[model samples]
Target: MELQQMRYVVAVAETNSFTRAAERCMVVQSALSHQIARLERELGARLFERTSRRVRLTPAGAAFLPAARQCLDAAERAAAEVAAAVGEVRGRLNVGLIPTVAAVDIPSALRDFRRAYPNVRIGLRVGASEELVEQVREGAVEVAFLGLPTTSRPHGVAAHELAHDRLVAVVAPGHPLAGETAVDLHRLSFEVFVDLPAGTAGRVQSDLAFSAAGLSRDVAFEVTNADFLARLVGQGLGIAMLPAAYVRQLSGVTTIEVTDAPARVEYVIWSRAGRTPAATAFLALLDVPAT
Candidate 1:
């Protein structure tokens, strides 16, 4: 089927309304519906179950949607490659990062990238380091920033280490340990803790550290956001261990050096197979060496 017909089908599937899809595609409703009907006839399958009240994808449509999306993405990448060959970097750049990213100022980097490559479209996804690494591997994300414990490194991806630092203990101002200039895991173990969700890279660092020291600590609160974790500590719910640089950005918490804290390494990772022009340009901006 024609690419235009595929585009119309995708639009209709996404919006679930031919009228809205037409508006999104900048075409008339009848024209968009007619094209989809023509495509369904050619494929010998009804792509959608349309009733007076709603439109839903039929089994055939559900099966066809993924391939249609891949085709559209391929077409876009091909056009981008052509532009890049002519010294124009114009494409979509999907970047992923952890919420506690501190090695690079992401907003400032994006601002500079926009100024340098005005034609390139940029998208950002915030997630855990493990999730972001998987996204990069699957090509859903073109570039990502990650922070993993020093014991582990990014596998199956092209990675460059950005920085390394140990985590620090955070406590409320009135907490017993707040006056301490530095504390070890043994001292912190006696206190309750707030931490990132279990099994996340951020959480793993602290967990591994305590386990290695033959210690067990109670994590009373589990949060997805680091800022929220800090807030919980500030309220004296529990203490937390977070990256030193990240702690400096938050208020209402006292940071004390963790003498036996787990170390973390920040990295920028991309697909080892290849990189899109937009990704390459962005990496160049960061001075990441070519792989």
Candidate 2:
């Protein structure tokens, strides 16, 4: 029988009258009678003894009472547990990050998030910015960090601007252009530029900036990873552009300002499928409090 049927059985047994039980259960007496009749039919036994003036339980009804009560108690407790899990600060919190962010920016933020959400299971996936954005939109990830130019943040998605990351030119110390305070766009024409492969967000940002400057910058090498770019610069392969704050923090790479380039902003993204407490709490951790 159904849980509600067991509940109806218990109510009738305790009150010893179907009319009283149905009223207490907020159902019509006839409906309650039908439910009990169906339940008894299924059980192949009598659950109550009816009389002209009153009603009482049969031996079978008395025998079934404890099971019905325990079932109701167990169901209530299970429902409460599920609610508690949802409302409390504990669950798997899936997050996405671009590889550049995972290496250059998120190390400290990740450590702090883990400490803040010790009970939360944090899963981190690193990929290109384009992949990260798609993952957030599809609900494969709860939050992400990406460099913006996202004219549209896709349908049902929300964004939070984190920081304006300055772009710097990374070069090996021995490169001819390394000692300058900053280089104008023309100096770049003399250098071998490491390109972020076509179709990536980083590549788009780089192209848009150069195009705005009325210069067609050439790509000497195309690579996906900025951390690797830093290493290439350190090893004297080419002079390239990268996020100043991130690349400067690494040793053996000289970061020089690139004149008049737009600042890169990191955005934290989430979509319409509401965030869990674990995800919300982690978002707070990633948020840099405003001045």
Candidate 3:
């Protein structure tokens, strides 16, 4: 089958609609459909189950999708290598970021990268650290900024540690623990806790620490936004443990130490399978060491 047909198959699987895939691929619907049909005939397997209501990948299609995507990635990487040989760095760069970790002067870095590579197009997708890592693996994003646990190394991706900061307890100024220089997590075990949602890096670190100390907390409020969680703490709704950098300057809240807390480490993660030119340029700006 042709490479274009494989692309059509992948696009249709991703969008779940042949028409939408055609739009994305910049091809007419009939031509796209015709090529996919030819591909299926050649392979002697049905790639998709198509109905007027929706398009779904068949077992065969599901099995083939990952390989198809890898083929496309390989092709793109080959092209990028050629462009690099000529000293050109012009392509789309999709970036994933966690809002809290984005406290790192990313805007200034992006501005400088753009000035150096004016022809590169940039797109940013914001999500929790866990979600951003998955997007990078799925090819939905080329690179990402994430908060990672100091003890764990992410599998199947390359990571560069940017900075490290300790987690601290945040509470309203009038709260009972407000005056303490350091708060033992177990002391707040019975108190209401405002926490990041499950699967986020911060939440993972907090849960592990509590579990290791044999402390079970009452997580009454679950939020993805660090700032909003801080506000909840300020209102005396609950106490929260977050990165020091996030809640340090917020009014109406007091930041205290979480004794022996694991440091929250910020990292920029990307796939090792291929490096786009724009990604290379941005990584250089971040001063990433060769891996």
Candidate 4:
């Protein structure tokens, strides 16, 4: 039988008075009586015993009362939940980041986003640019702050160029280059390099920057991510060219500008396809300056 029929049965059973049940159902008593009559006819069973002073349920009505109440309650609850899920801004969002190993401004932006959208649950995952990109393309996560222009921007994936920063050299505090105002390509050609992994966005940018200076780096160590590269640099594994955000904000490393270099980097990505309102709101924080 229809859910509406079950609701009528349940409402009549609860109130045990046709007049009260009609009021509860927000319909006229005549309409309620007509529907009940149709229900009983369809079920081929008598449901109510009508009397001058009161209305009471028959044995069959009592037997069906529990099932009818459960069906009506479930229908009402499902409607409420579905509306809240889609119409309300309170939900969970998963965002991925590869903004260097230790980021300053990006973290600050997240603080602002959290305070603004308190109901929107937030989670962060750190991975290489390659992994972040893959996670987004596979719909494993809702949003990611991966490095600019992934290897490919599939049709549905749209990205924005949020901030423009540069790669700087990170050297040990006691290294000879530590005292220099800036490191030049001519000076770095022979210096040992701690590089980002071969298939990551940072690596692509680093290779291009070095190539533009007409210098082939003396590659020493290649790691999966920038955080690993930074720690290695702290141990004097080698100097590295890292995004300014990570290098300048992180301890145990010193950043020096590269002399006479005309290179720039952009943090240019957000999950465009299938973005929920919560994810979209979080991404808006990226628009404000990285303070």
Candidate 5:
């Protein structure tokens, strides 16, 4: 089958409307129909089943859809690879970042990337680590900076460890633990904790740590933002377990080292599937070895 025909099939399958697919392909409805019909005849099966209200893919079409999309993606990647070979980086590069990424200087990295590849388009998004990982896996975001567990790795993605920051306990200056150089995990079980909402990287690690210590603290406040959690800790609202990189610089909090704490490891991850030239160029700027 012709490449254009595969493109037409994928467009129709995605839009599920012949007229809309025609518009997307920039071809008349009749030509699109004729080519699809010819493709069906050659393949000896109908790709789509028609209805008055909607168009649906047949079983055979369902089986063929993913392969068709993969072919299209492979073709585009091949073309992009050739362009990249000639030192051209000019396309949209969607990058994802976790809400708490203080250890890495992302702004400086982006500024340098723009200086090197001015033509490349950049899109930045901040999200929870789990959310960002999902976006990267689905190709919605081309690359992501995430806080992954030291022992755990996300499946179906390539990850490079960029930096690691220790998880430390932060308390108000007048709090009982403020004067301590280091505190054990179990020692904080009676204290009220200010923590990230459930499903965040910080929250996940904190939960694991508490569970490992066979202890659970009172989560008096749950905030989605790390800065807000730090603020709460600083105001004497509650003690919090947070990254040392973030809590160390906060004005109103005293950071106490957490013995046996899990390291908040920063990872740069991307889909294992082929990436666009723009994404590759942007990744090179970070100096991370491809995994």
Candidate 6:
């Protein structure tokens, strides 16, 4: 019924404890419970199953939760839209990006964004390119920065190409291949490697290159973080191939040019349906034209 009541319900459902929910919502336990009870009477369905130890959402509560969240999001968007019309941006900006993002410096960009729109709250999520893309399409993330193989493009979203570059080999200082100025995929494939997990966009670039060259490399370690992968390579665990720009920022590893390396394209993606004002402002900051 009331937005405040819905907020309390969502808070309780998420925390799974009336006491914690009350603390989170900054309301007394009795007050929150009373409001929820009043809401239940109005809706004619109990929204939660409370026990001595824990609280769980009832079937009806589960069904109502999603709609309640949507309502809250819509209301926030409406208020943000009005603010935007008056030349002020105020909204939550949820951004997702791959861990190896290089086209834009995320921390610096966020610093500038915060200074420009202090009222807008910013949230960041780091993930693989595929996961970030899906989050953008699903509206879980308002914008995402992705890096995919040159042969691949993000599907089901509006995207702007940022940059493309070939991957370079990264090896420990004492590794045999570390002294090489440049190497072909076939030559590199002979060595054990540390790489991102199989099927991830980051790993696929090297995999595709090796497969095309009719060579295969053993991935002795698979890690989600690029820094960790580089550390593994630095420790002589294995070698890795990563974006040229990204590799430059790492220490304790030697970077070699790859003559026949796979290239990756960086893209900034957003929902095709529409853009939130905060998202539009952030994209504008990056010089992305309106689409």
Worst 10 residues of 5 by lDDT: 72-81
Q: What is the lDDT of residue 245 in candidate 4?
A: 62
Q: On a 0 to 100 scale, what is the lDDT of residue 173 in model 6? A: 100
Number of the top TM-score candidate: 6
Q: How should the candidates be ordered by lDDT, best one leading?
A: 1, 6, 3, 5, 2, 4
Model 6, 179-219: lDDT tens digits are: 88998888887899999999999999888888888888899
Provide the overall lDDT of each model, using Cα atoms, as 2-decimal numbers.
Answer: 0.94, 0.73, 0.85, 0.70, 0.84, 0.93
For candidate 3, write residues 133-226 as lDDT tens digits. 8888877798898887787655678888888888888889999988899978778787899998976777989888888888888899999777
Model 3 alpha-carbon drift over 4 Å, by segment: 121-142, 155-157, 172-182, 198-200, 211-214, 225-228, 231-236, 248-254, 257-261, 271-274
lDDT of 4 by residue, 1-291 (tens): 788778777777788888898999899999888888898998899889999888889999888787776676456545544645777555666777774634335678778888887777777888766677677775556676655422233234555555556667888888788888887777877889998777576777767666777778877899876677788898898998876665665789778898754333344344554455666666666652221
Per-model tally of clashing residue pairs: 0, 0, 0, 0, 0, 0
Clash-forming residue pairs, model 6: none
Candidate 5 backbone clash number: 0
Off by over 4 Å in 1: 52-54
What lDDT is obtained when candidate 3 is compared to the true structure?
0.85
What are the C-alpha RMSDs, in order, of all predicted structures?
A: 1.7, 17.4, 3.4, 16.2, 5.4, 1.4
TM-scores of the models, in the order given = 0.94, 0.65, 0.80, 0.61, 0.71, 0.96
- The residue-level lDDT of candidate 5 at 239 comes to 95
